[model samples]
Target: MTIRFPTLSFAAVRAELLARREIALLDVREEDPFAQAHPLWAANLPLSKLELEAWRRIPRRDTLIVLYGDHAGSDLAPIAAQRLAELGYTRVHVLEGGLDGWREAGGELFRDVNVPSKAFGELVEHERHTPSLSAQEVKALIDAKADVVVLDARRFDEYQTMSIPTATSVPGAELVLRVRALAPDPATQVIVNCAGRTRSIIGTQSLVNAGIPNPVAALRNGTIGWKLAGQALDHEASRRAPEAGEANRAVARASAQEVAQRAGVKCIALDAIESLEAPDRTVYRFDVRTPEEYEAGHLPHFASAPGGQLVQETDHQAPVCGARIVLADDDGVRAPMTASWLAQMGWEVYVVEDHPTSARQVRGAAAPVHPDAPVVDEVSVTELARHLRESPGTTAVIDVTAGVNHARRHIPGAWFAIRAQLAQAIEAIQPARRYVLTCGSSLLARFAAKDLRSLLKARGSEAEVSVLAGGNAAWFAAGEPEESGWKNVATPATDRYRRPYEGTDAPAEAMQAYLDWEFGLVAQLAADGTHHFHVI
Candidate 1:
């Protein structure tokens, strides 16, 4: 006899959300879905975020985690649930019908933040007629000297290799995030491009969704089509914002702090943190610093938790409610931001205060244990590297980077797995193989290898996982046999692409319902004496 698992329907999930007193609503859609309208109180934890920055945002092992995606059949739900569970979350669920289901059920939806192109894609597809500007039309505009700026919505590396001569790199998903910096002149028509249809289709519509005053459209079929049409393309490109210094850190920190304060969030200190520790108390300490910083040194008692993801995935990080929570950071930015979100969840959240001996303490103490490392188990990079050198054939190298980055250059034979997709990807691989995971930097790779092993074990598979000593950046900086982003140049696949948009008052309803659900959770958790609660 086959066992049947319970599957919650859309109405049921929506009802659960409506009845909840407190819950974290995470949307695991692509950046485009999120940029276009999303349910109010919904935060983007793009499926890719898991591999790249999971440990940072989600430090709690038992926080209630509910995720939704664009399509009902979207792969994000299971992927997120699996990753969260591997990371130690006890209760994670997918929204039964995704955003569309909620809307169809008369739930609320919001438009202010919606990405126009995605919405437009749905609209165009709904009408079965997406207007396109032919190369001739673009050339006519260029020859006529029209006031237009072509924006390549691919990554900077891709833009550098080849792009429409009239275009500048603006990368999809990043378009809205960095729009203001790209186009200062609102009057100028913006032309978004990617290698082919999806991103260009989505990027162009995103600008329109955001209500950009300037007229915008995607370059018909992007650079690939442009090249096929025998049109000249430009190879010149530069870093959009090369200066990532104190100012940028300050901005990120300030934004985090502001968000926390606006939400009435608070932080706890170390001494105060100690008071809550007891056999009955479920205390979770998260180190919200960069992987490099955490690996180099971190609070002896803390686990790695990156800030951005911590905010986006609070419940997955901390599952048990009524627990004393402490967040540590070299710079106060991540800690405060994390504290703010946890506080919103009604947890007693605290940021460890600075101490002169902090650095010395971390360095002098035994290295922090990996989250997946058993109580008595210990391993180091040096030991792992030695194993790699000794057993090359048995080893598997997995490059967990942005699709664009992985496509350009990766360790030879390294399988590409975006963070959000890692759980699923790993499940299909050889469990007996030793694995090394990498991303832009080794930090995520380190965290990912540990998490991947946990997932494999949960499914009755045993896999040994290790991190690239320094990740791709480190590999390149050390001058290894590295390939530039120009190594592989296949056009991305667009056959499975689908963007759905449904207009309604559902966003407004969903937002209020979400707020009501959270408000109720505070009361419910408080009434449950077994659970101890504190505002971070």
Candidate 2:
């Protein structure tokens, strides 16, 4: 039986956005393809990993979800709609004529991930005339050891990977808070940069807006421009912004509070957060601190969304364009800095003022397991190894870890499969009497095992399913043999779309092309004319 889904016209979707309605215009395609061309507000929720991310990205099931894909040949919209419906989404629809239809209807398509945020950054620069110095100019200043400090406004890991010489790791939100401490002399020149334009522009403008005494400018085009200018970049540098003093903290609190207030951001307490939780509104509570800090301890019910990455990838972080976002941090700096950008991006954002004094705090990156998560039986890694040794063909091991992690190291003979593609993955594997699921930790594998059991039960198969206790780490600790590479992959590892600017091997041409695309986003935003951005 063919299932027909409701179709939304491109014009209708545009109207919905213009009307400020809660809509998730999703493009269920792999990241690389989706980045090539997509509607400005279309969130990339690839069908391949829908089960793993859909719930978090689009929290409300009743949200008006209109999915589209490459409609040139193969249509993925209907299939995605079916999957979303199965996942309990009530108001699911497919875009009529898909991408082609949107193009025909005069919809402005954007290239690259985080289109809305990047475009907003460009708009901010255009409106405010954010100051910037070219790579050569900044390099000359660094060579002369002038009264200058270069601040890398990217994540620490990104800064460690590659950065401008003499640049300190001071991520975007940290700029306003830590700059005073880093540059005590008012005559000092402060330069901010990231791999590309958005963070550089945002970070440089942040200090300027906060009335920092130092002369500030962005290292134009960041490390990319540095490399392009035949200037060498420093790798594995460990310089970081110093901790703010009481005086610095007081100043930052005042500056960030003023910025947040000007942006219409509300200050909410923990009790207020609880009250905001409702069936009708989708609220995203994020602790916009560094991952290391978040891992040390953070408030319950708040996910780790490092301030810099959250702003860079807002579309990926919050799919519902008009959703309310509440940001939290131990200090008053990161949350307000993050909330200000979110506000300018058209979200109803807030900063949590009260600290998590009495609230529960957890360690590690894994979010607390949902109460409704399915329960599955578990077996020890040693037991699984014995079973594999005894009945090699009868027992099958499925490693439902991230594709990149699986490629690095996995249990020998374990087939790599994404949790979202378990049903199809099981069918592709040779018939076995039993199946074992595992990830880096058993947390995700247990959920995968439950899914596998459901798929088996639906097919009336008697195959037993269980999660590997302690997962692949336990298997390695027990001295079990392991393998590497993409051999025996059940699904193509389209789970993560590689960024053009990530890693050292990206083609120079591609990087240049990416920069060119970003440079034109202001014009694209002008053409679209729907983004309600108000720079503070």
Candidate 3:
């Protein structure tokens, strides 16, 4: 059967991006290669996980999806196009000539993930000239016990990992509303910092844009600069911003509204949602509150995306560039502030006026809709444990979870295998009487079980195949013995991109390189000319 899909040239896709026509330029390769280099706007959707992620990430079935993945001997885009076609996506296309074609077409390539947001941060500073203070300057202020408040604009976990001395966790979206409570005095010098420059710049700019009463500036180059300056950081810090008072909330709302209006963000009430969501277009509804707040109560169909992370990683949150985005927050401050940044990033953004209440609230995370998997044989955790104990080597357990997860924990001797490269894994593992497949929740394992069956059948092997009833999570929940580390890694763990800014163990050189790369993103954006970004 021919896998039918159109081929889009670089010029064509660029036109769509510039025109504000929605398109998801997906690099259907694992995160590792996709991170090394790709078009500035390309989002990573590894072919192996496409079945599980495509529907959720892309959202709209008719979205203009352009995929490309072609390495020396492996070509994944065609296979990915077929898979998307099977999933009922009608407007799929392959980037003409794959990544090579993109480079040949003179496309500006960027390294690392979330290039759009990072580059936009640099551009924001360039255009707005967002004020900043060097790490040494900030350290001196802390040493002097001056009238200053340091706000960390990264996720709470990231702040807890390693933070500047005396810094409080006030993630991006929470800054405006919570800052007043943290620093009631209008003259207090407020300094913002993140692990690196992007969030720091964006968070500081957010305060500046919202007209916060206190004098504000970013900790230049963020923590990376702090480390380079020979400063020690606090570890296991638990400090966070306090809740805002009613008066502070009122002031924040007014300021955010003005900033949003300046950035050209649209506002719509709950009742007008139908009009905002045209069937012909894609509209993403995100609740830009803390995850805890969102899980307690949120509007149905609204996914939780903390405002700061949403701005820092827009490509990951909403891969369909140019799609309409609707942000929600009960306080009315976070949503509008987030909308302001997204609007300048060239997204048609909106802030929802309706608030979530317990009367009509939906609890917990928004689960993605997944296609039904073909029926396959299954073995429960207890049964698998018994089989492993009794049958020994006859039943080989293959763990099909993400490499990082597999390395972290797995059933004692399960071999790690990527679902896309299952055949290679099967060939490497010795012949067995039966095979048991599992993953985090068994969701991905169920799909992989079907693939394993077909591969075994094609080779004319009569081995029995089964999926672990609830996968690794169930196994762990049942007190089953687990092992850690890269044991029996049959396939390279290319599914994840190791972020240079994450984890305290990152080398100084790598962190400096990451900072160096950010400094040049503005020039790259200029060369690309596809990002229709602006600054207020």
Per-prediction count of colliding residue pairs? 50, 0, 0
Candidate 1: tens digits of C-alpha lDDT, residues 435-518: 777777666566666667777777776656767765776666655554545232222211112222111122434434433433
lDDT of 3 by residue, 1-536 (tens): 87667899999998998888889999988888889999988998888788888888888898999999985478889889999999999899999988888899899899999889999999999999999999999999999999999999999999999999999999999999999999899999999999889999999999999988889999999988899888999999999888899999999999999999999999888767768667768888898999999988888788899999999999988999888899898988999999999999989998987554653378887877779876889999999999999989999999989888898989998999988888888878888999999999888888888889989999999999999988899999999999999878778888888988777778989989998899999989888888888999
Clashing residue pairs, backbone N/CA/C < 3 A, model 3 = none
Q: Candidate 2's residue-wise lDDT over 283-332, tens digit each? A: 89898887888888878778889898899889988999777899998878
Candidate 1 residue 121 C-alpha distance from true site, Å: 10
In model 3, where do residues sit more than 4 Å from their true spots? 354-360
lDDT of candidate 3 at residue 398, scale 0 to 100: 94
Ranked by lDDT from best down, the candidates are 3, 2, 1
Model 1 sits at a Cα RMSD from the real structure of 13.8
Sort by TM-score, top down from the best: 3, 2, 1
State every prediction's TM-score relative to the real structure: 0.41, 0.87, 0.97
Lowest lDDT 10-mer window, candidate 2? Answer: 366-375
Give residue 483's lDDT in candidate 1 (0 to 100). 54
